[model samples]
Target chain A: MARQVAQRDDLLPVLAETFREHGYEGASLSLIATATGLGKGSLYHFFPGGKAEMVEAVLAEIEAWFEARVFAPLRQDDDPAAAIAQMFGTVTDYFRSGRRVCLVGALSLSDARDRFGQALRRYFALWVEALTEALTRVGHPPEGATALSEDIVGGIQGAVVLARALDRPETFERILVCLRERARAA
Target chain B: MARQVAQRDDLLPVLAETFREHGYEGASLSLIATATGLGKGSLYHFFPGGKAEMVEAVLAEIEAWFEARVFAPLRQDDDPAAAIAQMFGTVTDYFRSGRRVCLVGALSLSDARDRFGQALRRYFALWVEALTEALTRVGHPPEGATALSEDIVGGIQGAVVLARALDRPETFERILVCLRERARAA
Candidate 1:
């Protein structure tokens, strides 16, 4: 029983990695089973709804990880300028850690448009809202702050897409530098 | 012979629509065949390299269409601010025209990352270069203009994803308003 629990615990990261590499439609149950070294039956035992359940678990794991590593730091830093810079660094690290595209962004493109996409949209809105509030507290007007917040978030995502295509992290960094400067100026 | 040539000319828009709606990976040759009312053998005959060639043709066609309808206006108005607004309008129209995501952005997410991805990257760089040069000419420093240019482009792409998810085009308009205001301030 202990071994089974450990195996289940181990499956999340592997599944996240698989989803990152292959996307939702491309990542198959058999592929996840093989990667986790669990038989199909064991895989079914852990995720009865199959791929959908596995993806939900993956989304939860990623959301928690992002909240701790990315969003949490923003709350800790009171200086909006510094917080913005830290946010960029956190995203850079997250992307570099696994050389993965943003899972939420990737899932948004799926034809299924499952609950996974909804969860991702919610996470994005939360991040934008948090950033908007931070900028407002820093004295920028609400309109400007909200707009800038959205632009910065959007730019980071675009940079991620470019970074993946170019196989270089610097593309992401260069765009982030631009956004940081804008935030500081504000 | 004239009737056959006319038929081939009529097929391009349908083929382009298929590529736009389903994307490269999600779009199958069989579907294209059905959409175009061309048999599989006919499609193969016209596009010997199969889906890749067909997709390339579609992308090229769309690029030309954008240049004629979208980028052409930028050249018409030498006033940088006017040109930028016009550019935004063009982009808004393009997105609204078919509720389509940028094909380049969509293809970048797929496993078929080769020449197609490279082509998309080049097109994006071209856009940035044009916008940055215009901004620089309008008195903004090279660095600031380039950074802002990237932010605007990236923001628009991200907004498309949001718009699709929410089933609302207004999300795109909000992002556009922000981008235009940022440009004016810069």
Candidate 2:
């Protein structure tokens, strides 16, 4: 019984990685089964609604992770600079310094956005809003804070795309450094 | 006949749009046929190598357009600032002020990158290289030029993702305005 629960919990990361690497449309049931080391019956037992349920659970886990580790700190931390700095570090580690794709960002670019629009929208929106608040606390005017927040958030997403396109993880790291400098100077 | 040639040329944009809206893996031949108003037999006649051939043709057309309009201008234009400004204008128009997805950028984030790695890499690498050259002419040191080039290019791609994710095209346009301001300052 305990093993069953652990197996279900462990399946989320594998599913996330499968979607990240293969994308929603590209990650077929056979592929998911292969990645999770589960048969179709086991998968359906765990996720009756199938792939959509699997993706929903993955998105939920991702959102919960960011909210606890990243967003809440940006909004609630006493030190805005520290919060922003931590965001950079956490983000770097989260994306594996560019070796990993942003599953949410990748989904946003694909037609899967249509299937998960609200969750996708909320993820990025909460991020920008939280960072904008942090930037405002950092002494920028409201308008500048908002614009800069968008740039920083959008810039990170773009850097991921460029890094993957170039097959160069260092590109992602370099851009993060530059963005860090800009955020610090701000 | 001339009509057939024109149909082939016109088919490129439709195929690009289809792929842009529905990713490479999601875009089936039936979808392509519906988008291009061409039957499978005729599509095969034009692209004997199948969907791969069609995508290759689209990539070639996109590369050619950027070469003539964006990249060549960045590389050869006498006025660096003017060239940069013109690039902003052309890119905005090319992306339809954030309403259009960058097909290459989208593909880079998908599993399709594995299949079209060379063309995908060349498309972005050239854009960054040409932009870096233009930024160098604007007086930035080589390293700074390259970093800024990546930031600008990546930022644009990210903005598209954000715009689509948030269902707000203005987010994209707003980011572009900020990027343009940064480029001018550089």
Candidate 3:
């Protein structure tokens, strides 16, 4: 049975899951309605701009979550190593240890990128930036830190792809461990 | 007008691009017909099993191309370092320096993965395996070689995602250079 959503914000996670499961193009309004237990009328009332608006709200929520939980900590926390460690843990939990898809990354690969390109770009760019700051704080040189941050961020995205493709969550876990070690040694 | 395709094999690339542009679910029959300049009847004549068959044929073509161009050289070439270098070159060209999406990687992230999971798994597993062999031959220890192969393969896939997300082909190009160097150092 579909669960009731009490508020507009309550729909964000459900919408995000729908997008992750079926992708932006595949997630039909009907599928979303089915997922959220909301009729088309109610859905329209919540998101007058339709699926695009719903996705936008979802992306905003995701960005906000990352900012508070991952990015801000990476940038503002005094313990650089601990902050990086926390970032990895938060990411692991967020991605459900590779069982969940990165909706932004998935959309970036699909035609929806043409429409939501800016949001997608910002999601990744901010991640790389925040991580670069964290790495630099850990005493790595700026250029090397930037490159390593990109590698770690991109590596996480790719590990999710591979783990899902190979149906092996261990693959994701193993890569995360390696990445964590590399960051520590950096 | 769509270019004439005299052979069944000729349709593979068009199908691949259609899937890349629109994704598996988004690439409907009409869109494919429009892309190929073929009517419904002709498309059916060529792919009696419909879109699924067409996708299967495309995947097969991709696997064959990689096997001959990338995997075979990595596994069989006497100069492992050169083979690894050639793999990077082939991959960069194949992805069109990040302008082109990795269709297999994209599929692995979408709902289509439920249907094409095995093929997706084999595609990546084989690449990692072949590259591991090349790295080992290049003098890296067996365990390290395998892990490094995973990192490099996953890095490429992630780089593609990041490059497209940011609309910066240079992101992909830079990562490829880094991965190439990493492989050489390994």
Candidate 4:
């Protein structure tokens, strides 16, 4: 039998998915290893800090994704509205049309909250900061822009819960539409 | 020494808090027992089905809370807006001003989702249904009312996440206001 070595980058999304599907505490290392078709030892090789490190890596990856797809486009010199529209489409696809839940939200619970609280807080803060900047660029008042930015991110998280609960993909879509309306409100 | 016997009703909230503070997987019998100042054996006496039963009990309690405060009031003929407003106030207090996370959202992840998925989904659906009925009475279109109600519930869940992550109680308050606006929309 040939042994396959997994790269660190390849393991992050798998770990994120595991965390999303199972709350952070529920997703055991063995479960993650099984998901990736890798051994627990191999997972350790990639994440030296164990589950904690794996969580940080997954969160960082998610942040990077948002930065590239959503925040960056919002700052482009082209039509801000157009950029936001495209970003919304990508968000829908990334969340699998809102069928998937947020790993960040799941991991933020319980002991995981104590372990990853600062990073989680920073992640949300950065989102609000990034979105606020973009909204300001589009002529929204700073205070309202900041508030709306927070609401948009928070609202999307809520949409994930509702989507799953109701078994409706359209609920997630409606949230994005509401977000777009706020972005364009200014 | 006087022994304090905890009632089943008292134990439910403590267990709910344990689950909230720690994900369901992490909130062991020992921890839950400690929270209520009861022995592990005593916990079992109250919850014969073990962790699963405890979860069912907690969920049942939450449902009862909503039935009494939100749904029932919505169905009342006199001023649904007034009832909803009162319900919102109770909800605000129930969440401790957003300093708390949703046990439903936490438990709905991974395996617990499989165990309690239907219950969780039904809980959310029931909220949407009740809100839709009230909104229609207040003159909102049925479809729009349904969609908005889902958003309001989902948005609150997400807001809980954001508030925890951001360490901002105001974030939760802001979400309530957004919900209020949607509720009042005709």
Q: Is candidate 1 or candidate 3 better by lDDT?
A: 3
Residue A10: error of model 3 in Å? 0.4
Best candidate according to DockQ: 3
Clashing residue pairs found in predicted model 3: none
TM-score of chain B of each: 0.86, 0.93, 0.96, 0.92
- Candidates' DockQ values? 0.40, 0.85, 0.88, 0.69
- The CAPRI class of candidate 2 is high
**Cα lDDT for residue B79, model 1?**
77
lDDT of each residue in A45-160, candidate 3, tens digit only = 99999999999999999999999999999898989899999999998998987889999999999999999989999999999999999889888888788888888998999999
In candidate 3, stretches whose alpha carbon ends up further than 4 angstroms from where it belongs are A1-5, B1-5
True contacts reproduced, candidate 3: 0.86
> Residue B84 lDDT in model 3?
95
Error of 4 at B1 (Å): 11
lDDT of model number 2: 0.89
lDDT of 4 by residue, A1-186 (tens): 677765789878888888888767778888988898988778888778888888888889998887787777776636776776686788788787668877776666456877888878877787778777778877888778877888788888777767776667987898888777878854
Better of 1 and 2 by TM-score: 2
Q: Which lDDT tens digits does candidate 1 get at residues B31-144? A: 897788777877888888988888777777777776665555444446766787788888888778215667776566655555577677666776766777666766678767
Between candidates 1 and 4, the DockQ winner: 4
By summed lDDT, the worst window of 10 consecutive residues in model 3 chain B runs over B1-10
TM-score of chain A of 4: 0.89
Which tens-of-lDDT digit does each residue in A1-186 have in candidate 1?
335554565789999888777766677778887888787889888889898988888888887887776666555566766776778778778777214677777666556454566777777776777777767767778768867777677667777766665555666677777777766644
Task: Summarize candidate 2's per-residue lDDT along A48-156 as a digit string, tens digits.
Answer: 9999999999999999999999999999899988999999999998998766889998888888888999999999999999999988888878878888888899999
